[model samples]
Target: MPSPFPITLFAAPNTLCQTLTLTHERELSALKKAHSTELQTLVARIENTSLSTPNISTTSRTSRDLKRKREEKPDQDRAS
Candidate 1:
């Protein structure tokens, strides 16, 4: 199976200004449906994998350093 990344469709220079025939319209519709299904399946797999895994921590120690600085501000103001 191909990756679910976005795909671009290009029309020929001669066909660019021309109206699409019924066959071309059908083909375009089928391509769109296939792309949609692929995207849906990829998303489902990602969700299932995430659910099976443990939650990862995203917090940074920098926030703690910032909190410490804020706490020290009152002491500095008293010294002034």
Candidate 2:
């Protein structure tokens, strides 16, 4: 006579494994939501700072000057 109880016992570990996997997936989803919220808050803070400050053009002007210098310099190694 084959015992059916051994089959049930073998299946119990698979059930436990599925439950733990679901718990971990839920925890990861929660952490991802929290991080997204934090990133949004930081971005909003940066935007507010940029709007409030008046003298932030110095950095932009430097980059523009560098671009102009590159554009004015002719290609010296061109083979005509």
Candidate 3:
């Protein structure tokens, strides 16, 4: 079966305004269809990229520092 894509054919010049208008509309429709497919592809890529990334959440520097310091400190008293 022939593909749905438009075929390039040479035709005599269309003199009627209505014929030219119809041709222009058809071309625009085909162009819109192509852009729609491209947009869908981009959207899928964006979705996949977002899904593949790690979800790790990071605390602020001060909170991380506090947590590390707390871990390093011991219960033993330093004073005599």
| CA-only RMSD, every prediction | 16.4, 10.4, 10.7
Q: What TM-score would every model get versus the actual structure?
A: 0.46, 0.56, 0.52
Please give, for residues 1-80, the per-residue lDDT of candidate 2 as tens digits: 98876554555788989988999999999999999999999999999998888665887898899988787665533533
Task: Output the better candidate (1/2) by TM-score.
Answer: 2
Models sorted by TM-score, best on top: 2, 3, 1
lDDT of 1 by residue, 1-80 (tens): 88699766597755764546766888999999999999999999999999987655523556777899999999999999
The local lDDT score (0 to 100) that residue 11 gets in candidate 2 is: 55
TM-score of 1: 0.46
Residue 37 lDDT in candidate 1: 100
For candidate 1, the 10 contiguous residues with the lowest summed lDDT are 53-62
- Pairs of residues at least 3 apart in sequence or in different chains that clash in candidate 3: none
Q: How far out, in Å, is residue 14 in model 1?
A: 15
Measured by TM-score, the strongest candidate is: 2
